[model samples]
Target chain A: MSGEPANREPVDLAAKLASFGEHWSPRVVAGFNGHDVMVVKVQGEFVWHSHPETDDFFFVLKGRLTIRMREGDVTLLPGQLFVVPKGVEHCPVAEEETHLLLIEPAGTPNTGDPATAATKHAI
Target chain B: MSGEPANREPVDLAAKLASFGEHWSPRVVAGFNGHDVMVVKVQGEFVWHSHPETDDFFFVLKGRLTIRMREGDVTLLPGQLFVVPKGVEHCPVAEEETHLLLIEPAGTPNTGDPATAATKHAI
Candidate 1:
């Protein structure tokens, strides 16, 4: 565990997904390198913003996620991934209840705007 | 796609996992920042090595993966993850035909040693 302490205990996916119930709020489940792997249940639309310095990786675990960008929208079904590069304007919309895993730099704000209530909550 | 071109197509995970039947070899499926999101079907034992400057991340997509280190071995099951810090000698052994997703700096060899045959192939 000391060698890979971030996630030494094997986390049961279904159990972790079932542990939380909320929307747009990410719960940190593990860490890798300098990034944090988080899970969130989302529905409706998220704020339009962009990370100025790091990319955002999103993997759909359940349902679907449509990321609205300047050009078009990218819809991600379960088992799909999308990387939103830094400094790009984007918004994520979940038409139905969607389970997602997000990977990004540690301590990154949930929304680009720091004042947003959903900024950087580990749990 | 251009804004988030690395994984713009929203890759079908099942299809990708289904596409390949081999084990140990990693197929590049997408990128985040400068990192590669890869999936590999692994079974049996891997070499003992370490990346000197970058951390290596392993996520269990199916079955289980055990990373052996000096202190102890970290066992990862489905939905579990672990980050091997830079310069840590480690070996990965999968008890069964385990499917996994690896996230790390692009161009990293499958094994730490550069002379290894299984070095950096994007399938």
Candidate 2:
């Protein structure tokens, strides 16, 4: 690859989980340019917030998650994807539990707030 | 989420494989802004080419592969990532078999050649 190539072996979700044991917190899995790719295990409910200057993408690696927005709610199952626009307030919740792989800019606040506890957990 | 947020559920490789059986070809799993995130099942050998105006990224979701470059070769496994800079000629091959998740600009040529056989498979 012409871009900064990082040669790595195959990594499984079970192996990634073995590296951490926290809920609602994300851990760094890899990086590209100035961005950080994170994997998070979430259950129950998460606070509602929005990123004003950056874009965020989420892919469920395992389980299911429901994203509640100011206008409506979107439930995502395996193989499906949803997009939340910039400055759109949203809350993510899982009726049971969900595992997700998220990609975004480095230093993005977890809760989209610089002063919130979730912000402290940014991977 | 500030970016074009795509809410997607956990998509396992086996499930994705059940959707296709072709080798060296990719299918679209999701889209980001003007870009497309694709998953490809590849084995054996691939041709040499380069994208001139875009940056391409690859994450080894499964298996093993090596990128042969003019200078040297880089072997990649799962969890490892590589960025192929624009205009760099590179060839990919596998000693065994490999699956990968590739993200790049939508409508990009597969072999970086707009008129080549590989260009017909852009997902």
Candidate 3:
């Protein structure tokens, strides 16, 4: 068996979500392998943008999320996931308050442009 | 808005879990950034192993999962996650059938040994 390192603990997604109330701002919850697991609460439409260097992952935790692209819109409910390939410009909108889990490379900007992206806070 | 690529669709975790019944076998459900998102069903106990080069991520979807390390064990319930850092030898056990979501670098083995690892079937 491997020795557990100090501070290694399970992350409770629900508890993390409950700790914050801000919308659109993502909070870093856990990380591994150069990736950061983030949680965000969102409602309404977000700016259209594309991550030119990395794909964007979104897993709906509660409510509904609609990813709108030029071709069409993909709606996701809780327990569903969608991936937006790199360089694909899209917008995320939630008709109701929605909770989301996002997996992305560390330092990835939410708006694709670092200058305009919302600051990612660790929670 | 970004143009949606052909074959882009949301993945339902529940439906994917229901489609398979084998224990300890993982099915690749999605891929991005040289990483694979996999779903697995596990029960009983797994062999003690460690990934020498990559961290192991686990998110419990149903039932209970316990990751046993030399120092201690971490138990996870639905919506909980834990990351086993690289080179940490550990074993996963489940007294009841459990559904899990795992994220790791593509080609990483379940047993840490390629020859003994279960073949990852894409579903």
Candidate 4:
């Protein structure tokens, strides 16, 4: 939260989540400074990856999320958060459909690498 | 989410919120880069002030929060978030006991001023 607020646009998390209908794809809801607050619906599993330049913030909104890492696995329920450091290989898996709020650098991709299939895409 | 995640220590939002007992005072639950993630149980109204250097991120976890500013007031419900840009005077008011997750620069005082009573405190 280090940006200008001349043009304020309040975001309704519930409404924003309702408009999106895809899993593993994040929709940008808001931005502050150089970070973007995104929401994504995830199921099954996502490929293992890491953001070499920035950290990843994950807050579970619905259901549960398991973040697998070489060291161990992190399980997050609603109202829980886990931050995976930059350059740490990890994979996110969900037993069921899970809604998550992610805070990261604006251009960060789900799979970390820009050339990966999970790279930048539609909001 | 721009900090290094080495020596990661995940946080349980629900548990941290439960461990705190004061209102208007923030308890630091996590730190990333030069920022801190805090959880506070807020009730009543807070002082009006502005952080000249860094913006403030507010995510309501329970009940409701009304962030009063010169232009207008922003209402946030559970799962909703709002960012007050740096240098913008704002006051936080809650109708009842409300739980909140705050993201801001580390050592940031709740009053935006270091000399205020709401300045840095023990977690």
Candidate 5:
């Protein structure tokens, strides 16, 4: 191989999700570089937040969700992806149960502003 | 938001594989940089070959597989990943059946040294 230690392989989202039940909170599923990848099941709405130094990337593995941006909204369906540019305030809402892949720096706050108790480090 | 156009998002291997039925051959599911991300169903033995200028990364999405290399063999199970470094002559054999994610530069040969008829560009 690349002479590098193999990381976690063949990740199964279904199995991972089966291990927990929660909303908003995410669990670390994998890591690459200095970033953490988290998988979360979301419904309803998340708090509006902004990561000053980090960009957020989300992939909708299942269901439907919308990223509400200050200037516009990006509605995502399965196989669709969108990135919220750094410093942009946004909120995510799920019309139904959704499975998503969220990528950001390892320490990124679930709540961009982190001014409330709902902000979590589930990852 | 990296100020870049969004490409395909939130890929689901199951859905992609559902659209095709084949073995060894891969179908392009996504692209990043100059690389193509493919999903493949593989069983039995593959050819021994090498890509002098490219590295290949594999993630076992399901099942088990063994990479036979001149130096040593790397056996992979689900949730384990391995990268075949550039210029290594290796073959993959699945004792049972397997589903895998293969990432490599666009146009990389399926049979690395390519002197065969089974070689394909299903992606």
Candidate 6:
């Protein structure tokens, strides 16, 4: 993953998504301005959690993704994005396999709590 | 552009791109964690410049884009992205009409220099 200069090439989303298949395990594809650009695959419901310090950004790349919040549910398809504001408890669910691109502050845990967050690694 | 709660609904990239047709003028579609998610229609070559304080992000939504830099040129297509690191001079060019989604720190000027930057407004 680390070879050419970080800013020297383009990051192909489709190619990055194809490099992994593990559900819920996000792979860092790029970074910018103190944020990590990650791609993850999901098939079931994720934990209901909230990032107390940072907003969560989600862009659906394949299949359907529904982000359930206390206020309501926001369902997104390909080419759509939704941001879950900080401190809002939410869970993501996908009936079928789904792919996503997420942007969050660098080192932000996936589960909001460091103790329960999935281990993130660069692809 | 301000309507329902900012985080309550999804932002459709295609729909947002269709809502505007001005070249190089980016419309703010969403914001999170001090960054603005913008969409812009671009054609021709842009001024060569560099953001001294922050990195610049570019995601191609339609057509093609070529980011020219001192080191080399990186061309991108739909579903592809490239990040121009802070302090790196770059210029974006698109032979045909192109659509893009960009991420940058809130209030960052498009032209690097505030005096000549396009006045960015929310769509």
The candidate that wins on TM-score is 3
Model 3 per-residue lDDT tens digits across residues B1-123: 333472458899999999989999999988877888999999999999998888899999999999998778999999999989888888999999999999889999999999889999898
Per-residue lDDT of model 6, residues A17-54, tens digit only: 88888899998888888899999999999999888888
The weakest ten consecutive residues by lDDT in model 1 chain B span: B1-10
- Cα lDDT of model 4 overall? 0.80
lDDT (Cα, tens digit) per residue for candidate 2, span B7-68: 43434445665677788778876655456677888889889887867765776767887887
Question: In terms of docking quality, how is candidate 4 classified?
Answer: acceptable
Q: Rate the local accuracy (lDDT) of all candidates.
A: 0.79, 0.68, 0.89, 0.80, 0.70, 0.89
Chain B alone vs. reference chain B, TM-score for every model: 0.89, 0.83, 0.94, 0.89, 0.87, 0.93
TM-score of chain A of each: 0.90, 0.84, 0.94, 0.88, 0.87, 0.93
Deviation from native of the Cα of residue B45 in model 4, angstroms = 1.2
Model 6: which residue pairs collide? Answer: none
Identify the runs in model 2 with alpha carbons over 4 angstroms from their true place.
A1-13, A78-80, A117-123, B1-22, B49-55, B59-90, B94-99, B113-123
lDDT of 5 by residue, B4-95 (tens): 33332445667777776678878876654455668888999988887767667776777898888877788878755566767777789998
If the candidates were sorted by their TM-score against the true structure, best first, what order would they fall in? Answer: 3, 6, 4, 1, 2, 5
Better of 4 and 6 by lDDT: 6
Error of 6 at A85 (Å): 0.7
The alpha-carbon lDDT assigned to residue A79 of candidate 5 equals 54
Q: For model 4, how does the per-residue alpha-carbon lDDT over B80-117 read when each residue is reduced to its tens digit?
A: 88888888888999999999988887877778888884
Question: How accurate locally is residue A6 in candidate 4, as Cα lDDT from 0 to 100?
Answer: 35
Worst 10 residues of 2 chain B by lDDT: B1-10
- Stretches off by above 4 angstroms in model 1 are A1-7, B1-7
State how far residue A40 of model 4 sits from its true place (Å): 0.6
Estimate the TM-score for candidate 2.
0.70
Q: Candidate 3, residues A1-123: lDDT per residue as tens digits?
A: 343472457899999999989999999998788888999999999999998788888999999999998677899999999888888878999999999999989999899888999898998
Cα distance off (Å), candidate 5, residue B91: 8.7
> Which residue segments of model 4 deviate by more than 4 Å?
A1-9, A117-123, B1-10, B117-123
Worst window of 10 by summed lDDT in candidate 6 chain A = A1-10
